[model samples]
Target: MKGQIMDKKIIVLLSGCILAVFLLAGCGNDEVSSEYNIEYLNKDKTKIVDVPYEPEASDTDGMIKEFLAKLSSDSDNVEYRKPIPNGVEVTDYSLDGVMLSIHFDADYSSMTEVEEVLCRAAVVLTMTQIPGVDCVSFYVADAPLTDIRGNIVGSMNQDSFIENPGEQINSIQCTTLKLYFANETGDGLVEETRSDVYYSSNVSMEKLIMEQLLEGPQTEGAKSAIPAGTKLINVSVVDGVCYVSLDENFKNQDYQVNEAVVIYSIVDSLTELSTISKVQISVNGDTSGTYRDNFKLSDMYDRNLDYVVSLEETGVTEEE
Candidate 1:
């Protein structure tokens, strides 16, 4: 009878150990699962919505494939829409170092400008969340993606699409810009203080400055120094120097504005950003020729306040 009792107790102990092992395995599974934010466009396609998702795949490559599939698939929530439209298909993808390049079929090029931008933002924001992926680049029909303005849309990260606090993505933010425009006589620069300028968070400060300069000045005595019809190809900063590339239209100079005035308008406005201390202007990425008669496109210009005439001197009041 004692021997029988010992066998029963041993069985009970073994059962308890088995139960504890199962409990620990369950906890391990829970620990392996990770939550990631998947970006999608709203129904109206005006804003990007962040949806929390727990991917089944834990490995980097597996997560990327899962996320891409999810992006193209329908969202469980009614309010959100898939960023990759139905007709467009991701043909192929490759990962190199930290950069992920996704190639799309020709249908991708058919998307509207707004659709394209929102899609690009969504993909970049979502994919960068995966480990081993730091940036994303898009390709269509074997060609690198280009913006509406014909500039190559280079690798993009989270910072490429600015998000406002409390507002998820592509929200408006106010900023103040100190811009330089040509004086009425077109011989010197006039300072223009534009405050409360509302713009999309997606736009970088450097790009905004260039767009505003292209829009011309609101002040009475100030006029745009950049040639009309000129298109911005690209604008970026590196090592304290801002590189600005424009289309061939940039060579169409307004002879009335002094070459120096046109050059300084760009140089001083960009130098306003602490990150950029010098400005380099390029035409189609070629830096070899003179701008017109004097300024060389290859030269990196510094801030020249000497060319900047006071608003008072231009007979323009601050209120104007």
Candidate 2:
């Protein structure tokens, strides 16, 4: 009886030891699987780490912060002879299902605060068109975003079409109008990049005191009109304007423009698209030595302007 009692005690103790070992093994296995699911890219191979949930965008804030940190480091080495100007910095982001709202600052250029809001909309439209995302929004320098008219902006409701006039001239007003279309349409609207900048904002409201602004040429559209051989060599932007350098094309070929044409091209493009108050024109990279003296794009030079040229005959005909 004493031997049997001793055997029974030994069996009970062995069972408790086995139960403890099994519990520990189960807990360890759960942790290992959790770690494997949370993988990361370290230049090449994936590194696994333990995580608590199925990582969504909410779980991605820390990851994005780390990614941007590395991007900022890489950008430090980028050199600039003319200095590649930086736009507003994207500081924070909000994502609700398919819509992504980014927060940014716009003090880099003195253009306008409305640009920050519109620029982000361009980014959002590009992103939302992807399979998962459907729309995007922005906050300017931590404040709510408004349009050129100071109205609140948001994602388009029901699809809409945005129009393009094709290669006309290079005016910020024109480009900005196109940008507005993209924001309104939620898609890209570049008809043809050309090599001609116009000098007017016919659509803009006029002012007494104006700063002469220049516009970018229609780089792609001018291909058909320009000599078949010209190609774009370099492009530059300063103070919210684009400056393009072409490797010499058909300079002798003439299209007509009068003072009215010149003034209309510059001011119309500006006042229509932006709140800009003035404009100027340059051919190739140099200002025309005789632009304002007398109009000279052939017949285009003879038309009368409302302010500069009186409607009364200044030699420009109705057809001219």
Candidate 3:
């Protein structure tokens, strides 16, 4: 709908004759939900640990339904996410000023300029259209989002969002790492690096870092699980399983593909140590056996988790 939608290009010039085939396809095929409803709750946003909750009389899904009924849908307004073909589902809706935090399920963890531009456009447009949102931040599930190379995209950096984007991709959701290598012509747009980022929390005296993040220096494959210098911030080993604690920087929201890479990273790296069977994750030392998920404002998520401390059999709250 912008500037008389451009005409598709399909032209053939033969014998000094020119013929152009213009295809006009209406972008809208189905009715996308115009707006969503939200519920305002009073939350004390200060805490630093985990607190498990009992299933409430009312489920959170119902609350979500009520919340979505509050959006404005005057007309069929559409957000044109060009360049980026389509965005898959993660978290459904994000109200900027109200939530201040936004969670998105990654369609693909390996980010590129295409995703970067999509992000800028998506965040800005969503916030502009919705009420109660002044600024917006993105997250994976409970971790920070990253770039194609498994670099975590934590806040405090504005220069890279739109300009030099590839520098930020630390990982995909659940640990799928896709590296970017310059093409044969030395161009970086070809997206050729492919490897599984691994993890190795069980092996003591050795930490993971970029040096060990991948195998063979630069070649892509199931590389070492622990990046060199990734000291074991905290280690909780029970039975044959090891519950490793990593620094805040190691965690990201969009760690999907990176997670797969992590499993590969750990399994492959530790196969030589002792062939340990099970591995669990605890970000910054909080363990609920939760998945490796995070939000954008990862700095404060642990604090929130701490607020909801575990409730014992007596149904009384007790701090861990």
Candidate number of the best TM-score? 1
In model 1, which range of ten residues has the least summed lDDT?
9-18
Task: Compute the lDDT of residue 294 as modeled in candidate 1.
Answer: 85
Question: lDDT tens digits, residues 94-131, model 1?
Answer: 99999999999999999966577668877887898887
Clashing pairs in 1: none
Deviating ranges (above 4 Å) for candidate 2: 1-87, 106-118, 156-161, 164-320
- Pitting candidate 2 against candidate 3, the one with the higher lDDT is 3
Overall lDDT per candidate, in order of appearance:
0.78, 0.31, 0.32
- Per-residue alpha-carbon lDDT of model 2 for 1-320, expressed as tens digits? 12221121100001111111110112233553322121111111111111112223333445344333322232221220101114536677776876666666665234333333223322432233333344556566876666543557665311211122232221122222311011111111112222222212222222211111222233221112222243344333345343333334524332433333333433343334343433343446554454445633222211122333221223322221
Better model by lDDT, 1 or 3? 1
Q: State which candidate, 1 or 2, has the greater TM-score.
A: 1
The total of clashing pairs for model 2 equals 38
In model 1, which runs have C-alpha deviations exceeding 4 angstroms? Answer: 1-34, 163-199, 202-209, 212-320
With candidate 1 superimposed using the best TM-score fit, by how many Å does residue 64's alpha carbon deviate from the native? 1.3
Order by TM-score, highest first: 1, 2, 3
Worst window of 10 by summed lDDT in candidate 3: 41-50
The local distance difference test score of model 2 is 0.31
Among all candidates shown, the one with the greatest lDDT = 1
Error of 1 at 29 (Å): 22
